[model samples]
Structures are given as structure tokens and as C-alpha cells.
Target: MTLTQHAAPPEPPAVAAESVPGPARRRPPRRGPGLLLRPVFLGVVALVMLVPLYVLVVNAFKSQQEILTDPFGLPDGGPTFQYLDRVFHNAQFDIMRGYAVTILFVVCVNVLSVVLAGPAAYVIARSTRRRYRALMVFFLAGTFIPSQVLVIPVVYVLKVLGLMGTVRGFVLFETVLTLPFSIFLYAGYIATIPRELDQAAAVDGAGRVRTFWQIVFPLMRPVVATMVILNTFSVWNDFVNPQIILGPGSGLYTVTTGVYAAVSQFSTDYTVVFPTLLLAIAPLLVFFVFMQRHIISGLTAGSTRG
Candidate 1:
């Protein structure tokens, strides 16, 4: 009874529009120009930054005559440790002691800055009252005032507190200098975190202090790391503040002050100048190279939600 009713050959399956192969879709123009542009720009920047560093390192091992003749060239008779050793043993400036003292200052300032700034920022960020807002504005105002301008007044204040030329005085002032921006950064970052976490901690019978440190502060690592890099560089390279505050009389020379002490007497001596300069910057350069990724990531994250 099939009656020769073979079903009409099943209609050919409809061709997918994609399979129909309309004129080949033009691929988005390969972003050739943009791809080339970024690497070119970065190369130029790196070249500019590296040139002086190159000159400094090359000349560091060279004699004054060699440096004067060919400052950019490699050492004529191989790199010398003579200058480096001299730097280590120089009677006027003990590089090792300078390292120890500077590290101590760095540690103290960072600790104090974090300790004071963290709690203050937590309070400022959480509060909504008019005075707390005013307080924030007040802190922000400090950033506009140059540290250079504050040097004299700071001297007077420190003197009154019997802290001038003292390590405590320098560290405390540096810590204060750091607070404004730290709080600003912390508040902005904290704004991005949900209040629900704080409430949850409170529900668990945790006080505000415990809540911030235990729950929220750990979350602030990126912003905190950013602040650390900034403060470390500031305190490390600060010639004027340490010069004026700690003073030569105090004999508390940071790397920069020690460099100035060593070099000021031998301004024309290339061996001393170049080697001392190299030593002064070497540790920081290595640190920055290693932490460059962290610096970029932290700043990027801080900027995003802030």
C-alpha cells in the first residue's frame, strides 16, 4: 500500500545563512597602527630613562680621565671595585651605617604611618556627619601645602617639642606628612567595599576597631601597598627634610644626606661622584624593578573603584 507514495524527497535542508557564504565578512581591520604605536612609545620612554642610568653605571668604575673622555663607554680596563670599596670604607660616611640608619627610619615611618593613618581613615570613611566631612577636607588641605614650605614651621614646632634634630622628630614629621594622602587614598578605596561586611562583623559582636582591622583592612592590601611604595621612596630620597630636620649635627644621615656629605667635598671627583651616586640609587632601583608589577597593579586597582 505504499502506492508508490514515496514521500517527496525530503526538502534539502535549508542552508544556514552562515553557510551560505555571503561575501566573506571583512575582518575588523587588524589594529596594526595601534599595535605598533604602543611599543614604539614605550621603547622611547625606556630609552630616555635608561640613558642616564647607563651613563651613571658606566662612569662609576671609570677614572676621572676615562669618564671625561668616554663617559658612555664600558670600562677601559674592566670594571673596578676600587670606588665601591672606597664607598664602603669612607671615613666621613659609613655606607653600611647609613644603610642601617635609613632602614630603621623607613621601618619606623611606615609602621607609624600605617598605624595612625589606617584607623583615622576608617573613621573618616565610615562617618557621614558634616564635621567628619570637614575633617576630611582639612586633611586634604595639607597635601596642597608643599613640605618645603612647612619646613620652617615644622622646625619651630619640633624645637618646641624638644624633638628637632632627633630621629623621633624626623620620623614623626614624615609620618604626619604621609597621613593626608594616605587617608585620602584609604577612604576612596574603602568606599568601594560594601558596608554589609562591616555590619556582618558587628552582628558577630565585633567592635568597630576589630571589624576594620580584622575584616576590612586585609581587603585594603592593594591600596596599602601603593602607599608603601610612595612613602618608601619619599622617605628614602628626601634630602631636604632629613637635611634640615635631622641635620649634620644629629649625625643621622640617610643615604641621600650621606651622599651629599661625601660628594660635596669632592664635587669634581668623578670616581667619588659616580660611584657614590650609583650606591645611593642601587638598592632602590633593584627594589623598584622587582616591585614594578605590584606598583602597577596596586595603582590600577586603587584607581578603578576610587
Candidate 2:
């Protein structure tokens, strides 16, 4: 009893006032200067980025003499359409044929990729099976593997398929290459949608295919827009894919490859160079401008998981 009682002197009566856990103190809202300066900083960044484009447009009209003399300066005289006309009508390069091929490339890749990816994604997002999950993971893994890395194997395959020089062949390659990214996007977006909708559709006697089209597909609009804009931009502007798949000399060359082939034609003529560059980039710029709103809305709309 004595040995037990001597122990520890009651440990200071077991202090009862230990600090209680509570909500973290919030940092004070950042004050005036930081908030005020953010927009100004962004504006400056935007201006800096636009400078190159400004240079391109301004010099695009200047005479070759003007370009050589004062390339950075504003247009010295009236905006000339001479080089623009040349870029458009130069039968030597067949600019419109390039445009047609490029448009076809974009349309085929964008439309087919989305159509094929959408169903694959829905299956991935809804299925409880491990294989579906594994398949989805397999697709996402593709984003990390650059197309450049597969050029040798792909070329061999294309040669085997006799698609090496043909437009359809290029389309086939582009579509296969495009699918993984498209599926990655669609699957992520569709996962955020409620399962209840699918269940409700099923209860209404809708089959899986019908449910996807009538119920799930419309809900996929945002991702579809995002897919179109992103894929179109990528495939349209891609120089490397076209360069390898369709050679620079190939008549089936897209705008990028065609324009590059024309580089030697101009022979470092800056006035022509500027306008040709402008011609090459105008479609992308126009596409971005028109879809800028849809693009923004679509990207933002699916960020939340519900």
C-alpha cells in the first residue's frame, strides 16, 4: 500500500485544460496592392505575348524593302495585299488544295475520334469491372507516350497496310493516335455525371445503347466541345505527325507540311514569309476566336465532380 501510494504525487492533479482542437485561424484577406496589381500583371503578360503576333501582322503588309530595313516598325504605308494574294493563289504550292486536305484531316480526326471515344468512355466510367478500369488506365497511359517515339513502328505498320502515302491512310493513323487522348478526356468528364441518371433511364425501359444516346450523350456536350476544339487545334497545327506520316513531298500534305514545303519557294523573302505565316496561322486564330466562349464554358463546366 505504501509503495503504491508513493507513486508520482498524483501527476499535478491531471491537468484538465489541454488545448482543444479548433478551426484554423484564417489568414487575413490579402490587402490592396496585391489585388490591384494582379490584373495589371496579367495585362502586361498578355501584351508581351501579343507582341510577336503584332510584329507578324504589321510587317505582313510592308514591302520586302521595308521588311529588311525596319522589320520592327509599324507598317510604313498602306496595308498591301500583294503577298496575301500570292499565298492564296500561288499555283506552284496549291494553297487551296492544302487547305482542303488539312480541313479533311481535321474533320476526320475530330469527328471520328469523338464518336469512337464517347462510347468507350461511358463504358469505362460506369463499369464496375476491373478490365474496364484497366482499359481506361491503358488509354490514359498513352498521353505520356509521344507519337514521335512510335514513328518507326507506325511507319512499318502503315507500309504493311498500304496507307503510307494515302489520305485515308493518314486519317487512319491520326485517328488511332488521337483516340487515347480523346478517351482520357471523355472518361474523366463522364465520371463526374450522376449514376442515377443512367439507372433512371434503365428503369424507363431504355436499353444501354439507347440510354447512352438519349440520356448520357447530351450530358457529354461540354467534353465533346472541348475534345473538338483541342483535337482540331492539335491536329491542325501539328507539323511533325504530317511530316513523318505524309512526307513533305506528298501531295496529301496538310497545311503545315505544305507551308513548310513552300518555305524554299519564298527563299527567305520576309514580306512573303510574314504573310505566309499569317495565312498558315489564320485558321487557328479564327477557330479560337469563335469558339473561345464555348471552349471556356466547356472546360469550366466539367471541372466539378458531382
Candidate 3:
């Protein structure tokens, strides 16, 4: 009978509850519903944000009659590009020139901003001097002031310099308008990086310029991408600045100002204007979508690290 010798009670499995050094507790299984809520919430939010966009897209392809008759509905006649044609072909607004000026203006502003701010931010971040605080305050204060307040002064200065309504003027003004914020962003982000990197670069033959270009600049990619997106959007869609600087009926109109050309005191061309607005925003939307991944990291970089 004993030949079926009690197999020694199976030694407790290595990670058995009783074998655990402390009171053993099991984690509740993550609930599927709770896990699913985030995507569901985001999807709902995305749909909500897209309602206006849906209206624009639907109305852009339709006629004035369709827009008035079924404002909330999709295009009855499919996408009609006549409005686009009219918007671009209108004699009052030089749409092609506007596009050219806009591209040039955006490029120059981004170039000047990155080139100037990169070094300035590096210096400000790495500086130990007490006066740097004042400098930082000066730059960041520009962000708080409404641009309208400076309109008269900006116009006067540009007028004196013979830069008014010129692409050069737009580039200079946009760069100045944006620099403070760009420097502020770059400075905050650069501070999080350790000095060890700079030192390592210095230990080699790398000087300040080389160190910054080779070592520091590469790490600033996320922040730079963020700046590029922001500066491009601001310069591209600028209405008030272009209006004030370029003056009435200026050939230097951008896509934004071109949209304004569609409006009059007595009536507005909703069909053409709406399509033009869509065209104006299309580049911004596409850029944001493509660069969306970099945005989160870039925005957070200043607060993270060290």
C-alpha cells in the first residue's frame, strides 16, 4: 500500500503564492473597456474637430446655388473646380505672384530665424551671467504684446526703409516678429542638455561653431522641426501684417490676403472664398500631419531631460 509512497507534497513552485517572501497579491487584469476608451475618445474628438473641415471641403466643390440650398450637405454636382479657377483667375488679385511671394517670404523668415536664434539660444542657455535674465525677458516679452499695437511703428519703419510691400520687408518683419518666441523655445530646450556634451566636443578639436553645428544642432532636430512648422504657418497665413505692410491692392498678397480679396462690404463670395480658404490652409494641414510625430517630442523637450 505504501508502495505508492506519498510523492512528497509537490515542493512549492518557485513563484508560488506561499513561497513569495511577502503577502502575495495578484494584479487585476486590465479591463478591455477601460483600455479601449482612449482610442474611442480620441476618435470622437477627431470627428468633432473635422466637422468644419467637412463643411469647407463639401462647399468648395459645389456652386453658390448648391451651397445656399444645401449648405450642410455634400456636393450634389461632385467637385466643381470653377470656384478655384475664379479665385485664382480674378484680375484684382495676382494669385500666382501671391504664391511666389508667400513661398519666398516663408523661406527667408525660417532661414533667418533658425540661423540667428540657434546661436543666440545656445549662448543664452549656456551663459551664467546675470544679465542674460534681462535679455531673456526682453525677447520673451515680445510674445505677450499684441502685434496690432506695433502695426503703426512697423509700417513706419518699413516705409522708411523702402521695404513696404516687398518680399524683403515681409521676410525681415516676420523674422523679427517670430524671433523672440523662437529664441525662448530654443533656450528652454537647450538648458536641459548637459554641459558634458559641450565639454566633450571641446576636448576634441571642435570649436564653438563646430560644436554647435556638429553636436548640438543635430540634437535640436525636434525643436527645429517644431519651429519650422510654426514659422512657416505664421508667415504663410499672415493677414494683418501683410495687409498693414503691403497696403490696399498690393500685388504682394498672400493666400490669406487673397481670400480677403473675395470679400466686399455689400456681399461676399462664399463659394469662391471658402474654396480659397481651403487652399490656403491645405499646406498647413499637410505639413502638420506629416510632422505630427516630431511635435510632441519637440514641445516637451524643454521640460524634459536633466
Candidate 4:
């Protein structure tokens, strides 16, 4: 043996514990001026958005004297319910009734639009034919047509059908006005659903109607919730339609019309008018508070898909 016997196999290179695969390396902490600006920016936005609402509520509770003398001051005198009382008693109960009518109109429009548009949307989404695409475009185009332009023709047709000045007539018009947008939204959302779901249902011997009701309709709940919130808000707040179609004497007045009427009657009385305006908006505020989560969820979900 050539006494060159490997020098004891050179004690295997010492394995340093720290050099072994230990926990992952941590990234250095981020530092920048932008990080400090985020909260400040959000606070500014929040303050900007809250100013008008704060003024509305504060002014609503103040007396006409207080409003004129110190528009921005907190009530120096004890807050009085006089304005609300006047709104309730002197406004001919129209405010209350108008709220009822608005609720009815919103519910009717929401149901009718969803029921009618859902199927149409489903068909457009599933159909491969060029005609369906054309129809979808036609529906979307209708939204661009001003309601003012159509008012004359709509009134003429309603008069011929003896539906003018009637709540039913208003409901019908709202349904028609909202339908195009509803169908467009639903169709866009439905397009994102996998066709295999429908096919799978079909393979199980489910017919079109069954497949739609059991499978597709349930999936559309989020979009439907969003549409209901949007449509209800629009129809409830609409002024021009009810003002023109319902006419002055008709009891078919909605909250918007009633508030306008109150404004006309109490033009000089800030106490009366402001309270009435507050009352008119209260329902919408309450509704938004309760349904905001659903509306946001629905919109976000729909956007991700379609």
C-alpha cells in the first residue's frame, strides 16, 4: 500500500448547523412614505362623504330660526319634535301613503323584472345563435334611449290602453324601463357559469325548465340580490316619471313626488320641508343599511365571474 493511504479520508468537511437548510429567510421590513398616506387618504375621503349627510340630519332637527341664524350650529335650544309632528299631521298623511306606494312599486318591479328577465338572460347566455347576441345588444341599446324622449309615446299608448294615471301603469313602465338593464346584467353573469353543469343536469334526464330552476336559478341568487337593490333604489327615488304620469291629483304619488309637493307647499318653512325630506330619505337609508352587505357581495361575486 503506497503509504499514501488517504489521510484518514480527510475528516468529512464539518457540517455547520447554521449552514443546514433552516427556516426560510425573512424579507426585510418595508418602509416608505406611501404607507403613512393610506389611512390619511381614507380619513379624508370619509370626512368628505359624511359632510353632506351630517348637514342634512343636523339641519333637519333645527328650527327655521336656528337654520337661518346659524345653519351649522348644533341646536342651542332643546331639540323639538315640532318639525316631525308637522310633517305627520299637516302633510295630509301623503308622506306615509307615498312611502307605502313606493314600497309596493319597488317590490312589484323587482319581482316582475327578475321573473321575466332571468329566463331571457339564461337563453341568451346558453344560445349559440347570432340572433340571441343581436337581441342582447338590442336590449342594452334600449338603456341609452332617454325616458324623456319616450314619455310622449308612452303616455299616448297608456292613454289608449286606459292605464295612464294608474299605479298599475306606473309599475308597468318601471318594469319596462328596468328590464333591459336587468337582462343585460344577468346575461353577462350567466355566461361565466360552466356549461357542463347544464349538461350534467341534462344527462340526469332533467329538462330545460328543471335544469334552470333547480341548478341555474339558485346560482343566480347573488345577481338577483344586486338587481333588486339597484332597481328598488332607482324606482323609489324616481321623481320625473311619477310627476308626469301620475299627475298632480292622483293618489298614486310616491315618496319622491310627495316630497316635491311638500317642498312646493312649504317653500319658506325650512322646518317643515327639511323634516319631510328627511322622512322621505329615511326608508332608503334604513334599507341600504340592512341590505348593503348582500348588495356588495352580489356585485363583487358577479364581477368576478362576468
TM-score of each: 0.89, 0.84, 0.82, 0.86
Task: Superpose all Cα atoms of candidate 3 onto the true structure and report the RMSD in Å to 1 decimal.
Answer: 5.0
Q: Write the per-residue lDDT of candidate 1 for residues 32-77, one digit (tens) a residue.
A: 8889899999999999999999999989988889988888999986
Per-model root-mean-square deviation over C-alphas: 3.7, 10.8, 5.0, 4.1
Stretches off by above 4 angstroms in model 1 are: 1-26, 30-38, 303-306
Q: Which residue window of length 10 is worst by lDDT in model 2?
A: 9-18
| lDDT: the better of candidates 2 and 4 | 4
Better of 1 and 4 by lDDT: 1
Q: Write the per-residue lDDT of candidate 4 for residues 209-271, one digit (tens) a residue.
A: 898889999999988998999999999889989998899868677888888877886788899
Q: Which residue pairs show collisions in model 3?
A: none
Across 1-306, the per-residue lDDT of candidate 3 in tens digits comes to 456656667676477666658766899988798788989999999999998899988888888888888888987757878887876766666667777778888888999999999999999999999899789999999899887888889888988998887767767888988899999999988888888999999998799989888998888988998998888888887889888787674656787777677554214567766777777788778888898888788899878776
Q: lDDT score, residue 94, model 1?
A: 87
lDDT of 4 at 296: 77
Residue 2, model 2: Cα distance from true site in angstroms: 88
Query: How many clashes (backbone atoms < 3 Å, residues ≥3 apart in a chain or on different chains) does model 4 have?
Result: 0
For model 2, the local distance difference test gives 0.83
Give the better candidate number (1 or 4) by TM-score.
1
Scored by TM-score, the top model is 1
**Which portions of model 2 show Cα errors greater than 4 Å?**
1-29, 32-37
**Tens-digit lDDT string for candidate 2 (1-306):** 456545554455554555766788999987799899999999999999999999898888898888888888877657878878988876557777888888988999888897798889989988989999999889989989888888888889989988887777788878888899888878878888999998898898999889887888898898788878888888888888788888855657677787777776876788667887888888889989988787777776778656
